[model samples]
Target: MGLFTDAYDLFCIPPIMRLIGRVYYGDVDDPKKRYQVPIAITSAMVAIALLGAVIGQLVFGHLGDRMGRRRVLAWCGNWRDYPLSATIMSEFANRRTRGGFIAAVFSMQGFGILASSTVTMAICAIFDAASHSSYEKTPKDADWAWRLILLIGSIPAGLTFYWRMKMPETARYTALVEHNVLQAVNDVRNVLDLPLRNEELPPYPSPLDYPFFSRAFFRRHGRDLFSSAISWFLVDVVFYSTTLVLSQLNDQYLPKKENMNAYQDAYNVARFQALLAICSTIPGYFATVLFIDHIGRVKIQIMGFFFMAIALFAMGIPYFSYWYDHSDRGFLFLYGFTFFFSNFGPNTTTFIVPAELFPARFRSTCHGISGAFGKIGAIVGSIGFYWASQQNEENDHSNAKRITAGLVILGGACIVGVIMTRLFTHETMGRSLDDNENDHVA
Candidate 1:
């Protein structure tokens, strides 16, 4: 499932991002009054995607809590391999280097994208040529090209459903829910590759030991959920804002057309920027994978947010001044700073923490909620960036301080997240999925 999903996800993002430039910003030739609307609407669509995730989370979480983790994991596994795979893979894989694992898996995705991007780029080239023609024709080529790409990519996904529906419920889930001591004993013995010396381990608890939420039960979960969601809300707002804004910043500084004197120049600069991003993600994933067990989830979160606060505060001063001075080189330094703190700190942890703190029963739903709030943040950041950029684009003197203001606000939110992390979030590193079966279930 991870392999399949990563394949789709790794490729989907570059195209989606490329499309954002095309759909919302349009060609750089026809730049709009505000670039914020498209960013906001697309972010809103992301939020909408989480709505389905929320429903799935709630339904599946309850089923998992009532039935067991294995069943939910099985469902999650297959779903991740099929229709829902791409997004899930992207979300998860932004964390670590699974050796050549992600690289190898995403090759199929990359190949698919290579073919599609080629066709699309070809259509784009034709459109560019046609636009320059004396007849001044309107080109609809790229739209159809994108549609065909979507259709072709979706075929493999649609075909995989046949295999998924026939897959069995995970053995762990069956053991707990069926409440059959003998079968449960056999499963544990087989999976662990150990003989079951004790026979009484299986029937230790009744199947009715689930549905673990009532008024008191849900209140506790709600506190954790809301805290988790709010922290993510804060993180996403600043993270996405900073990222999307950096993209605009890059274009402004790099000026693709101006720098296009040679083909290698264009490719080299883009590759250098990509290298920065790839470098940033490495330490963040390593920290999570290595120290998450010893250093603890909340501590890492606190440290990450702290890193952002310091980074943002220092960044704002030069950020405002450099743009005013039109110092492209100086702005490049600030952009690098933004990219580093983003992937190394809040960006990675926001996704990781929710998965860790929430119990398996409610983990998916909480994740959905967190993801939803994150989308809301994206919307605000999107719209806000447009407004700020438009202000900067128009009245050069004051050059709306809104972008600078967003950084400070994000810093503040990180402080809140720190507090919330200390209060409600738990350390789940190295804990097995079945460990939660004994959690406060008198």
Candidate 2:
């Protein structure tokens, strides 16, 4: 539910922008006001939330390590969803199916996105029905609609807070960070519904031994940290930017909703986004859940990057000719494949790898850093794509070149991601969490 709310809040923003513009802002159709809407919406509504996310990830990550995953993961009551979920799942997961387990948890994001789209469409429908009027072209009467939708996001998050408080800390965290091996084993026994092993083990290492940012920490796991953060940053730059700019690309194929009322326009846009989620986005997540363990994170990510690059190139390069055709489905196939590969590929692997790659002492912290970096990429992509498009309009350059360049840049990002994976990232498939951590204990 935490990750679900995360995806819901992020995606719900785009469809409601028109409602916001018509109700809260003025004259978005004006050349003077045109650029203002996306920028203001992106900054105030979208970018600011993501910025908060970066800070939240870092702060909560640190605390999760210090206080315990269950104790600190209480954010939303304590942290963002990824690190906590990944950490708990990784620690608990069996070696053989760990990737699939983690990926399955992450897969809820697809349904979350689908929920966001469905809810957006339904809300618009309700408002249209209640008002007994098509949404006005320059809407002023329906200001309540957006506020209601935004508030609805809080409901699920609130419900999940109780469950989070009830959940137990992972055995790995209890044993390793807190240096309470007996308690750790007890926790594990309860979680797995198993009898405790009677075999004795060595004395617990002091928490002081694995101090973050110490010399030993750097030597043991610095490379993995760098790879996780940088690769995530690269993946998100393209992902966020492409998402924000996709409408422009789709605008070529989809006829502009001229003469339509605000509700009509919003509904169509909301419905379109929902279709994409249902048809491509959600399915891609399931693919990751199904195959990530078998293919290996490294291979899946590599394939995702290559295909994303090819699809972006196809979309961008053909923008002027074949891609822009009035009735062709070619661009959509390419576009949908990019979305597919992204979720099934880097998006899932990056999140999973960070949680699994590092020792428990630094696990959440490293994952937080990587997740934060991805947000940085998202901010860059969103602003950059918008600015590039605005520049194209102002300079009288063709829209095709604008799309082509933007997608090409994203493709280049995917290429960089592929290199990072090959050179830096260690595959996490079929390895026990204990095995992964031992590499950092030297």
Candidate 3:
């Protein structure tokens, strides 16, 4: 389900961004109205997704405890079946090279969208720039191009169909939930290619008595949820805030005055952003693969967030200074760092950790719960950026003030994330499920 969800969402991105841009700026030529609409819709959609995810986490999470993990995961696959094709591609390699391969899959998702968005936005640019003399051909040609891009982009999602039909449920999930110690043992043996003994089977929790609300369960899981939620919140807030501000900054300060058509300008800006995202995200994943194990998740998260804080501040200085003596180059550097570190930073772990840490019964719920908070943070960041930008534009105040506020808030949130991760999350590297806290190995 995790694999499927990741892949499906990746392909859906270009359309999502296109829809967002449409809502945010019906016509990108107008800066004042540009971000407001898109951010507003973004806020709404995220709010809804967050709400549904939280309730789903609570309900489905509890159900996972009552039902078997395998059953619950299978059910979740209804929404989770999008990434199998990519996951299968990653699964064949040996362990040493697997991370690189899987990271490539993750990275390719960005590249796919970058390519799609680039072409889509290019069409928009061409249409927007067309003269009245070209008016008769403009609409038809632009529509054809957009339809073609959509058709091509949809291919990746279609590719997952075959794999989705054949993938088996995780054997570990079956073992833990069904309490069939012998079957569980055999399942693990099959995957690991080792012999199994009944004596070696793990002890199972009492499925008859669901323990979701019990003090023991809360004691073990509550702190994790809080920590995951807060960390996700911080990541989303800072990440989206910086990304959006930087996008707007590009056009505002670095206006390609040579290009005067509004649609053309927006298309170029979007294409530029798509390229930047691909460039930064691919490298970021490699950095994660290389350093995540070596530095440890705790250190990687802290370093990533802190580095982002520094970059945010660096960008904010000039923003707050009213571009006092320089151009938007300083701001662009900050934006670039934000994009780079985002994929390279806690963003990766934040998503992966929630899935890895929790018990199988609650994995999706916890992931969804934490993911919900992340969405809230994304909404806040989007709305906040729009509000600040609007205020700055309306009152003729220095863009610096809003940029400073955004950066300061993000820095503080990063500091909080570092603290939560250090205090709450246990070291999971190479640790068996039986060894982790709550001891659900059985």
Candidate 4:
């Protein structure tokens, strides 16, 4: 649910940005500047949440490790719950199902994206009906539409707060990190609803208490940490760049500016986003859930990155001139595949691997560290791409060419992801958390 809220809040902004522009920056005298929100303002509005996320991930991640996952999770706000969710899922799930479990939790992001688009579309439709005036003629109606969409994001966050508080501390954290054998056994017994056995339980393994920055810890997990962080960073660069720029892409596919009013423009953009999520994003997440365990994280991530690169390059390279001159449908098809492979590949795997590869004591912290890097990538992608897109427009570059440049850069990032995944990551499939944690000890 937290992940759901995260996606909703983050994604709902793009469609409404034009509405925001119409409300504040609309210029009736100049057609080109009419609905254009300044690039600086647009970038700031989109990147602010992601900037906050980087800080929140680091702070909450460390808190989850030091204080306890359940306590930290309950105390932290919903938007920063990614690392905590990954850690808790990793600790609780069995080895055979761990990848799917964690991936399943993250998959809520797809629904969140879908919901944001759907809700925005509904709100725009409602306002369009109520105002009985085109937004271009009376921009005030757009004000209400964007606000209602943003407010709806808070609902899921509020609904999940109590459940977060009620969640039990993971047994792995209690047993391995806290070294509380009896409490851990009881936690497992209660969760499983199993009869308590009279037989003695095995002694808990001695804690590997290396500090996160210590040489011992670095030697054990340095490669995995670097792998996870860098992989996440690269994927997010492409993921967010493509996502936040969809409005610009939609503009190309949409009918001519003279043909539609502002309300119709906003509605169509939201509708297109919803369609993309339904056709590509949601299916990709579920595909990961189905295949992640069978395929292994490393293989899936490498495959995802590789294909994402292929799809992106197809849209950007040899076909760039063709796309610029030709069918929007052909371009959108390849574009959709990038989202598909991202979910089925590195995006899901990066989140899962960090949670599993680290020791119980440092799991949340490492995941947090990794997630922070991803957010940094998001910030770069959102702000950087918007700036680039604006620059292209200023230079009289066609929207197609601007989008092509961004796609090519994103493709390069995916290629780098492939290399990094191949070099730095390890397969965690069917391996116990304890086995992964202790494998680097010697």
Candidate 5:
């Protein structure tokens, strides 16, 4: 449920951004404009939320560790939901089905995307219809439509907050982090709705006495942590940037300004986003939910990254022909593959692995640190891709140059992800979190 809301809020940005850009930036007569967003301001407006995510990941991660997962679990509009949800779900999931379960939980993101696109599409249809009656097809009218989309995104988060709090703390966190055997046992019993014999706490160094970024952590889990952070950073740089910019680039497919209204542009973007989510992105997520455990997270991630790189190259190299011939059908097929393997690959594993690798004591904190790194990648990719998409505006090859360059760069990023996964990630298909923590030890 938390992830569902996060997905809804996170993805609504693409179409909403189109609407916002139309309102604030207005229609530019020069299709050759240097940038879709003011280059200086893009990071502040479009990427600011990611900056908030980095802060939220660190703050909430540390708080989850210090305060315990139950207290720091984010249920609503908090961007920290990225790490917090993963931590909570990882702790609750047992080894037998851990990967599949966590992926399943994370798959709510696909549904959330589905919901956001569907809702936005419905609203766009309404607005497109109403525009004929009102003769108000300008930027001013589009403002309220996008605002309403954001308001709808907030509603689910509000509804789930009270119920999310009702869930009991995970037994692993109680036993491992808090060192409260009886309470842990009770939590497990309540959560499972079954009886369990209370067990005694094992003697070990209290995680409360240790700091996460200390030398002790370096010796134990540093390499794995580095891997998680880098992989997530690479994945999001590609993932978020891809999703965010896809709609932004719709001007190519849109009719020329003389034939297009703000309503038509919005409707096209909404429709594009909806189709991508419904046909490709959601299927990718469910594939991961079904297969992460069977394939192993590391293998899936490595394969996902490799294939994504290939697809990007396939689309990028033929840029001029694709554009002139209206290669959307074939382009979308390759584009859809990239989306598919992404969810079926690193996108899901990156989120799942970090949650499982660290002990409950450091689970959220480490997850946050990893996720924050990913957002940095997101920031870089968002700004860089937009700039790459705008090169040589007046030249005959300008569009081709930008499209080819963005894909080449993003594809290379995925290749780097493949190397990182191979070196740093351990197979955790059926391993317990306790098992993972010890594996990283010398």
Candidate 6:
């Protein structure tokens, strides 16, 4: 649910930005500027949440390590709990099925993205019908539509707060990190409904307490940490840039803004994004759930990045002119595949890896650090792509060339991700978290 709200809140902004422009900035005298939010304002609005996310991931992530995952989560009292969720799920899951379990937790993000598009479409349709407005004229309710979409996003977060507070700490954290063996056994027994035992147990061994950033810590985890952080950073650069620019890309299929009202334009963009979520994003997540454990994280990530690069380059290079001039269908097909490989590949694996790759003591902190880097990438991608698109329009450059350039950069990022995964990361599949971390210590 945290992930669901995160996706909805983040992805819903682009569609509403159009409505916002129409409602507030619609009266500009300059034809190019009319009904468009200024580039500065647009980029700031899109990047602000992601900027906040970087702070939240770092602060909360460290808190989770220090205070305990469940306690910190209750205090967080909001969405954007990716590190906590991944850590808890990874700790609780058995080695054989850990990948699938963590992937399932992250898969809620796909539903959240779908819901954003679907809800926006529904809201636009309802307003259009209620106002009895013609598609040819701007709707007076554009402001209300965008505001309502944002308000609805808060619902899921509110609904999940109590549940987050109620969640028990993971047994691994309770036992290995906290050295509370009896409580850990009780927590697991209660969860699994196993019969209670009256027998006393010996105390568990204390976990190795390596200080973060110390020499021993670096010797054990520096390479994995670098790989996780860099992989997440590169993937998010491509992932977010593609997602945020999708509305603009839909302009090719949409009629001129002058020819249609704000509501109609919002509805069409929402519909197209919803279709992409359904056909590509949602399935991609589930595909990872099914194959991640079997194929292993390292292999799946490599395959995902490789194919994402292929799909992106197909639309960006040698064939850029052909895709742009000839077939909208072909362009969309490649676009859909980029999203598919993202969820099936690095997006899911990056989240899962940090949770298992580190010791229990630093799991949340490491995951948070990796996730914060990913958000930094998101900020760079959103601002950079928006600026590029605005420059193309302002300078009378071809939109196709602007888009192709961005795609080429993203494809290159994915190619680099492939190489980094091969060199720096290792397979976590079929290995217990303790075994994986202990091997590094040894």
By lDDT, the best candidate is 6
Query: RMSDs, each prediction?
Result: 6.9, 2.5, 5.3, 1.9, 2.8, 2.0
Where model 3 places Cα greater than 4 Å from the true spot, the runs are 1-109, 112-115, 118-153, 180-210, 253-263, 322-325, 437-442
Worst-scoring 10-residue span by lDDT in model 2: 198-207
Model 2 C-alpha lDDT per residue in residues 189-282, reported as the tens digit of each score: 7777878783543344444465786888778788889999988898888888777668645654544545555566667767777788888888
lDDT of 3 at 311: 75
Shift of residue 46 alpha carbon in model 4, Å: 2.7
lDDT of 2 at 414: 95
Candidate 2: clashing residue pairs, number: 3
For each candidate in the order shown, give its overall lDDT on alpha carbons: 0.49, 0.77, 0.56, 0.83, 0.77, 0.85
Q: At residue 108, give the lDDT of candidate 1.
A: 38
Tens digits of lDDT, candidate 5, 1-442: 7778778887777667666666776656665452144555665776787888888888888888778776777432456866778888888777888888888888888888889878888887788777774344354568799889889887778777876678787777777777787888788778878767764433333344457758877777798799999999999999977876654555656554335556665566667767887788889888888888788999999999999999988877776656545736777788888899899899999999999888778888889999899889888888778767655666757767777778878899999999989998877788877775455443
TM-scores of the models, in the order given: 0.67, 0.93, 0.75, 0.95, 0.91, 0.95
lDDT of 1 by residue, 222-293 (tens): 666676677777776776566545455555544343322122222333344444444443444444545544
TM-score computed on alpha carbons, candidate 6: 0.95
User: Candidate 2, 340: how far from true, in Å?
Assistant: 0.1
What is the C-alpha lDDT profile of model 4 across 1-442, one tens digit per residue? 9889888887787778767766776656677777778888777776787889999999999988888899988867655888899999998899999899999999999999889989988887777777765535444667777888889998888878888887889988888777787788888888888876624555545777667889988887888889999999999998888888745755668765555555666777778888888999999999999998898999999999999999989988855467666765878888889899999998889889999888888889999999999999988887888777777454554655776788789899999998989988988899888886566555
Scanning candidate 1 in windows of ten residues, the lowest lDDT window is: 82-91
Candidate 4 structure lDDT: 0.83
- For the record, the alpha-carbon RMSD of candidate 2 to the native fold, in angstroms, is 2.5
Superposition error at 101 for model 4 (Å): 1.0
Task: Tell how far residue 407 is off in model 1, in angstroms.
Answer: 2.0
Clashes of each: 0, 3, 6, 0, 1, 0
lDDT score, candidate 6: 0.85
Clashing pairs in 2: 74-78, 75-78, 75-79
Winner on TM-score (2 vs 6): 6
